[model samples]
Target: MAYSHVSKKNGVAYYLHARVTPTANGTRTMYFFAKEVKAGDDVTKALDEVPAGYIVVESDATGLPLLKKG
Candidate 1:
């Protein structure tokens, strides 16, 4: 598994940095609340409380990093 602190771009969370475990396997990246998240659990919900120009990274990326989106 990996973890990143991504800010929202358009409507999705984008990774600025992450720590990949090199053995993680999943379809969706897991998001965590920086203030209330616990270990061994994954958050699959989208966040809606971000500031107009800022937000914490939602989760660890699930696959090859994306450079852009459609």
Candidate 2:
């Protein structure tokens, strides 16, 4: 299953989505979500509000939570 990374930049929240290219090396592409969460937003609560069949993961680089498909 694919996963989406959630990150906060300048007090705003964004989502990074991974896209795989049909290339010989299978290059991966990252994209940002169209929506943004305002500052002071509860990230943990947002994670918990995710619907079923999805899981939250921590980003190794940012230590932020990411949403992934189960």
Candidate 3:
């Protein structure tokens, strides 16, 4: 199952997704969350857990989830 985060304020479930892109410096992996999984999203790229050294936080105003490097 996709990693999920429940918004404390809104109580909405958000599923985590990841995408990898090639850059001049190197490959970069981007992480995000959505209410539903997209069709083109790779199953392998969808994270099953919070990434190591990272923490999830909520926006104070919007209550949207965010990933923070810990």
Pick the TM-score winner: 3
Give per-model TM-scores: 0.17, 0.33, 0.85
Q: Per-residue lDDT tens digits of candidate 2, residues 1-70?
A: 2223444433334443433345577664332232343232222112214446766665667666665788
- Looking at candidate 3, what is the lDDT of residue 18? 81
* TM-score winner, 1 or 3: 3
Worst 10 residues of 1 by lDDT: 13-22
Task: State the displacement of the C-alpha of residue 15, model 2, in Å, after optimal TM-score superposition.
Answer: 12
Which structure is stronger by lDDT: 1 or 2?
Answer: 2
Ranking by TM-score, best first?
Answer: 3, 2, 1
Q: What is the Cα-based lDDT of residue 55 in candidate 2?
A: 66
lDDT of each: 0.34, 0.44, 0.84
Question: Residues 1-70, candidate 3, lDDT per residue (tens digit)?
Answer: 8789999989999888888888999888888988886556443266789999999999999888999999
RMSD of candidate 1 to the truth, in angstroms, is 12.2
lDDT of 1 by residue, 1-70 (tens): 2233344433433323222233346444333333222343242333433324444433245432232222
The residue ranges of model 3 lying beyond 4 angstroms of the native Cα positions read 40-44
